[model samples]
Target: MWYYVIPALVIFGVVHVYTKSWLYILLRTWRRDLKALIRFSKVNYYLLKWERRNMTVPKVFVDVAAKHPHKVAFYFEDDIWSFQRVDEYSNRVANFFLSEGYQQGDCVALLLESRPEYVCLWLGLSKIGVKAALINTNLTGDSLVHSIEVASSKALIFGSDFERTLKDIQSKIVHLNKYQFNENMSLSKTLFDNAKDLRVCLKESPIDAVTEHIQKGNLKDHILYIYTSGTTGLPKAAVITNVRYMVMAVGLNKMVNVQDNDCIYDSLPLYHTAGGILGTGQALLCGATIAIRKKFSASNFWKDCVRYRCTIAQYIGETCRYLLATDDNNLVKHSVRAMFGNGLKAQIWKPFAEKFGIKEIYEFYGATESNSNLVNIDSTVGAVGFVPFYAKFLYPVSLVQCDEVTGEPLRDSNGRYTICRQNEPGVLIGKISALRAVNQFTGYADKVATEKKILRNVFSEGDMYFNTGDILMYDDFGYFYFKDRTGDTFRWKGENVSTSEIEAVISDIANLSDAVVYGVEVPGAEGKAGMAAIVDQTRSLDLEQFAEGLRKHLPVYAQPIFIRLVDSVELTGTFKLIKRDLVVEGFNIHVVKDEIFFYDVRTKRFVPLTKELYDLIMQGKVRL
Candidate 1:
């Protein structure tokens, strides 16, 4: 009896230790991968069925509407749009477009604000196999004209709200037919000579389903073209196929456990992939209700969530940081249990969730066109996603060693790309296969642009993979963490420095409202020198305390050599930092209006950057 009892105790001790180890986390992640695959199999079955029937999103939406006709599909400000109403409205749009002689494969440019009609119009156009180019509403002048011309749009459909914007670019876009729809139900004629009133046409059009005239297309057909942010350069139109839309919608819905009863509060612009596809897809594909906001209001975010009784919320870029900076007195107990998006920083994750009473955070990582998508299902603190060692074959995603400067994959003597070891930073790539929807890369509308993203002969003779252009690392637990973008991570003092990591630290130390970090060229520096632009609206930032904090929290090499203080930071529509202009102006006092400072090695403090110092730095007289 003594011998048997001793053996049992020893076994119990071993089991407890195993459960506490990283191996246990890896095992749980494997279980999660298996369960996710099992759930995704259902999506594949429907995709196959839809492909065989040659059905697109509109057809699938019709089936969903039949089951839940009276369900509230969208909540926009003071109005509620029911499934039946949206379905009928979309049918009217389809009929109206058909009457205009718009055939399958024709392209139309859509420039509209965030509203239910945006989704309805796109869905309606998709019915006739006409792909809608969803242009960024914030674009103006040359950028706006280039977006339309790049897509080769035959027609431009815009809301009356953008009439002024259209009038400015009317000369450039005069070749294309234009249609303007009134948001308010008033019968109004278009201001442009070539533009027509789409609202009036829609009112007279039949509301009956245009099933007979629906285009004969499969899941692989292009339905929409969502543009990139254009932060670094001009926006590129990424092709969104029916299958890609469904995959994005279903994959996120199933993994995050979003239900039909959930109401998602989306304040993001409607033209983006996060807002247009993922947010609206919940309502169209999963039968959930979406609450739309024209623009993000950090002060009113929580109030709106409570008002809508939303079960889920969406955010992107620095949205979470802005919310955290807002006054807490306005926040109230609400029904939002989950918050999902891509760019929540690790420093504010736990605090934001706890303060807002959020139960789960589905932090995800993916580009508008890349097939390399990831989501943190279990709410791991800093993890974007997880892929266990044993589950690599199933996921088809790997981290490959690459040149930090150029982001090109490094090949071994075998002429094959080498996989990064655990805890090593590498660029993430997803194997592309035409056979599976999950692994397919639909790519951009430009053939040359699309080809540039595909890395051929990755591991074998003819294997192809989509380069994600993001640097990431996985720990021993198989939890992946986002390091930085390929071009954003610069080397300094023989050490690779991540701009995002430094930005997070600066934001925390200085109590800054916003911060943008980048690398700038110094005359004598071997690599790019670090520079940080911080927003101090009230001019309350204590430089001494900030310097002390940085010294304590960050390594000596990772510290920013130059600092620029601005009243505010310029951001893209999605709240992403616009660094192109800032980077170009880089520590040049003559070009930059903002106050600049530099770290003095002897003084061990930040000192005002005078013209003499700037000249010295440029002449290589001052050591960086």
Candidate 2:
């Protein structure tokens, strides 16, 4: 035994020495490769020299359009736009903008849908130096006005279908001219030439062609004003410079193995950052085909994948959860091989991939205004595998003893933030400095709102850090997992209540299609009580049965205090439920005509909630 042990020990020692020597060589080579990657990514900055000559973004698109004129650029059901058609439409719109006196560096608010017009307008705006403020078309009243004003937009372009939304905010829109796409262009005017059965090109413009606003704009100059998804609070617009967009595009494409032949079935809304910037930009820059969809449809997701022969796609929220719930939705011939996006849960990752025959699941992390990103590129070459994305993201996050009562970051004996050890959940704050800083909000800076979002001197006396307001945690493998929004997360009695968790659960009420969960003011409660507004896919909700099923699935505090059944849940154009609207309505009969019911705490049944009934219950005139 000793002789064998000695031989093994000697071999181990020799291998250790050789392994260390090889590891050093491997590290040096990786460092060089990483530097090249980082340098190529920053084509607008100091590393612009590394980029190929005459291959700038707009030129790249023009080259592609001229070469692949008949190739499909955008599609929905049967609606289609070829590369040449897209370019021509964009040229016409660019000419339209030029004729309307839109100069370079001017801001234009685009409030439209996922149509050819929107895509052409976006590219055409890029051709000129006009920065597009992709306004959420679903936004109404103050929100819409605030977003438009925040962008300092010189002009607003909206669809004819949104006349009411425009009217609601007409009194509040800043000193800006408005144009209706459907109305301004005569209905008689054709979107494309009727002469060509398959293709069309931009004709010689009788209208004054737009003069080049910027002859040689720096890549660092921002082109898109992207509004945050607003799961936490009012949306803040993020600055996305051309350099950053390209970096992320290349980073994501390389990280996720996106190639020119790959086709991505896009179901995300075009207004969102993921849909336009990360998803579409990755496809365009990587020379991948984009099969466009108007919006997400869980029941038809698989069919769409099969129809497009898509090899990749993007997702967010509990999109997978809904897809999984549609039992038969997974049963279809799909050519999908890989998917690149973010916000997939660990619990569903494996199942989602196995269920769909996906070979790669490239979950990512990056925001419109964030510089740091993590890519889960751990799959083995030609092998089905999994690994989570990892990065410090410019900050050390920990489950410190924050002020539980006021919900603020806490300090310890050392007067420094108490870093939560591995696997503990905590709020994430990105360290801002010369070497690293999240891209700040863009637009004419609104100091009032800007300052509100930033955290000053967080680490030192005068340094600043951007507040992400997202709770995140790292596992043993240094993989960060998303938890919940900071203030939006709540505790109910003895259990932590994830609003997203409840929303996901309630959204699975067999017949319901969507749900938005929020906490509301309740008498005798230390914290707010949970409430949800659900949309019924099977006609409507059964309050009694829903309450019983909810009780079976949830603990006492986790169950919603009030259930409101609505015709449909109102959401942003990006498909995020607008909680502020729901919270304001809050089971108030006068505000919302939806049926409201109260959970009978004792009986575990729901009863119709009436104003008099509420008054009686609050006054102790009624018992649970």
Candidate 3:
């Protein structure tokens, strides 16, 4: 006993002496790491209880409703719905679907705006094991028909707001049933033969049949079809399972630290995953309220937050810019303390927070179909995801070296992927192994597109991984930052330029609401030349100022050689910048409707693209 005590005392004295020097720093770091680990475990432990039970989104909502019956579940412009009320409404919707001959595994197309009824209708369909194809309400014509056809929907349920678009494509849509929400009985009876008011649909009493049907379904079953933003091409129908929705609900609630009395301010469209699952579904899961807007109004954004008493909000990359563009002084007075979503630009993160008094911004990186998902819980500016060193072994997310041109993972001599070194940009990939349930990539309904996302024989035989098309880089601390989309990165002057990075810079310019950066082929030039299509709201396109800002921020090669100023730029329903049309239109003054300008190297200012300059550029005479 004496020997043991003496040795312990000696060791303690030595440790105390070490604490006086820099050696004490290691212990502090260890303590901080331990705290983070405990916090992560606590959050996951609560979520795991439901994940183990295989609880679906509808089931979770029901549970919350049972717990907080009188609590406000949803808030629209002038309407408020209690949790119990919405739960009963969804039950009526389930009964209505069954009465109309809907069955398990049936597909229904939903074209509606963000409303309390819209959410209840979808949740009701989910109760009866029906997958709702969330079509973009902005879509019409052939695109709308194609989305419905691709989804193989048996029914089309639309809102009265989109009655005109529905009527235009009414004949083209080959669905077994067409139903429209008879809001105020304004929708024409001739347009849609089967029209039912939302109130009339909610007349049926809540029944046990819905709960029993939901209990019969498994976690792996498809719950919804979320379409990708067709910015690069036509949208693909991504299959979302019950388990995935559960993950979104629980995962977001935990990450954002949602409170029971909190109200979420969500202006994003419901058709997208961010607005649908992460926004509304999260609020339902956590027994929190939601303030949904019909459409995103930049001017009314702050006023709505204060009006609804919203403590949380959802946003995309473009959301902050629009809010910042407004001059409304109401931005400072609000209950919004935190926000959760992806696509928040690094340049706007600090300003957006300081201006609006946001305490936390849970920026994230994920797609509708990809299994690779990560969230930045620590509010690190510019970081899309975080991978703590202690959890790195458990997390399968990784960056792999890929071909710059083909955007494919590079194979080694044994046909194995080479992991990207720290601080090097590479395409992010996540392992999909039977050993890990969280890594399952349930992909799209189209088998070909599903297979296209999978990479085989990576790292080991029979190994598979999900390829994320975007490039990312992680620091030694495991903070991941987005570089650019694989296809969006273009080579110019023998160097690669990230379109997203450039767009972020341009988006930071005052009065420039939005920008789309792309590469266009230049005659005799080594590779594609950088071009920008910008939305100038102020109509004060000072060429000297714009060029000066570009020079200060970007390198000569990375700066746009041509600038096209448009009154409005096209965007996907999810608020992502669409560059396909801009890329196709290029800087051709003859074909383009907007004003085009070319960078004058000699004067270091942009000059209007005239016939002589266009000819000079086409003939390789211009230095640009």
Candidate 4:
């Protein structure tokens, strides 16, 4: 009897400790992951089914249209387009392309803004096994030519809104056929040589469904070429296969819980992934309605939501901050319950949510070409996503130690990359496997570019992983947080300083509309010194209060050594800050016309960065 009682008591004690310790938290995380995985399995099932049937995106969309023909598919500036209308319009586009002798594997360059027709054009081309190179509409001159030439596009399609842009590059792209789609019935008397009217062609073509036998592509074939944001260099076209499109769409749909009745307000550009694929995918794949805007307007953001009865809205980069700057009149009343996208900083997250009465902020992190993706399902502040410690085998994403400068992984004595410990920042990588659509890395259209992103022999011999080029950290609770880009984090005063963190701090302190931080070389310094460019159109920022706030929020080493005031910050179409030009200009007063200031250690204030001080710093006389 004593032996039995002692064994029972021991078992009870073990259970108690396990439940009381961090293992209990791990259990909850595992439960959350398990639930998410179960939901995601549905996407996998459809993907597998679609692959087996050799069905493409257009085919699936056609089926969805048959089911919800009368439902509103798109809402664009007082114009409502039903599913049936969109489907018929797409059919006419397909017939027109086929009539023009565009065969299977042909490439067509599409330069259009955010509109219902933009989606229909791409969907139509995909139906005939021709891929649409979704060129960024903001691109001009050399960049625009490179985009068109890189894809080996056989034809160019331009919206009437960009007729001048087309004319600028007309001579450069004369080798290819061009078509112009005019919103208004009025046609230009002076059309570029070899350019035809796309509207006339569509009107002449029938609106009936394209012949089933004419559709000649599988789920694995490429459907669209979406370009990466050309922040560091020229935009690289990322291959978007039918399978990849389905995975991205279905994955986001399930994770965000987008219902069929929900109307998604999409003000993002149509050439990018967030707006082009994921936003329109709600309607094309999940039976939801989409409200498309030509461009994102912070002032009219909520008003559009109210007008369209939008239940979900999309945002990226500095959109939230821009919205926060606006007055609270339209923000308070809206039907938007949830907002989804990436780049929602932690500083403004709570304020934006509370002010707008948003119930959830589904912040996510992913590159256009990378297979790795993360979403904060539980609305955890500052967390991009999480993977439980016990569940790493299931989701093969890891943070590995790497060279901070070149962003190359550092291998241990055994020649295997070392994984970072808890709360330690490292380059994020994801294992690539061809066994499933979710794990596959479709990569860029250029083979050299594609190969550069693949990291071979990562954890084990012959194992490949996609280098995400982003630094991230995970805590004891398994919530992963984005730190900064590899090159964006610079070593200062023998400590690594994250520009993103410092930018957030500066933006909050100065009450700035935008802030861009970068590393600039100091002549005698061991490493680069931190510099910040803040948007202050009126030059009304309180320097004294800003310096005080910086002292309170950041460490001495993490504080920016120099600051430049700019009237406006150049941003990408998606609102991401462009730092290439600013980095090159550095802190030279001659090169930079803007007002510059430097931190004064002795005075404990920010003083003007004069030519004398600049020369002193360059000559290594003044310490950073």
Model 4, stretches more than 4 Å misplaced? 1-22, 213-215, 229-232, 487-624
List TM-scores for all candidates, in order. 0.78, 0.67, 0.75, 0.78
Regarding TM-score, does 3 or 4 come out ahead? 4
Higher-ranked by TM-score: 2 or 4 = 4
* Candidate 4 lDDT: 0.82
Candidate 4 per-residue C-alpha lDDT over 266-345 given as tens digits, one digit per residue, 9 for 90 to 100: 99888889998889998998889999999899888999999999999998745776788787655547899999998777
lDDT of 2 by residue, 380-477 (tens): 22111112222233233233435432235666565666666566766565555543222333322355655655566565667555555556666533
Q: How big is the positional error of residue 421 in model 3, measured in Å on the Cα after superposition?
A: 1.0
RMSD of 4: 11.1
CA RMSD, predictions in order: 11.3, 12.0, 11.2, 11.1
lDDT head-to-head 1 vs 2, winner: 1
Output the number of the TM-score-best candidate. 4
Candidate 4: worst-modelled 10 consecutive residues by lDDT: 227-236
Q: Show where candidate 3 strays beyond 4 Å.
A: 1-36, 185-190, 194-209, 229-233, 328-330, 434-437, 488-624
User: What lDDT score is found at residue 558 in candidate 4?
Assistant: 66
Task: Look at candidate 2 and tell me the lDDT of residue 316.
Answer: 66
In the predicted model 1, the residue pairs found to clash are: none
Residues 1-624, model 3: lDDT tens digits: 787998898887688666543344334345535544665565567556766897777777788898979988889988889988888888888988888889999999898878888888888898998989998765555557767988889988877777777666667764448776755554445356555555555565455447788787777778899976322334578999887776666666766677777889989888888888888886677777889998888888888998998888988766676677668554458888899887677877898898888898999888877778888877889998777555667668889998765466899988899999779989999988643445778888778768877998988999888988878999766789988666656756424466766787787753577888888877655457899988886668777888887875565667899998888877656233356667677888889978899999999888999989999999977887
Ranking by TM-score: 4, 1, 3, 2
How many pairs collide in each candidate, listed in order?
0, 2, 1, 0
Better of 1 and 3 by TM-score: 1
TM-score of 4: 0.78
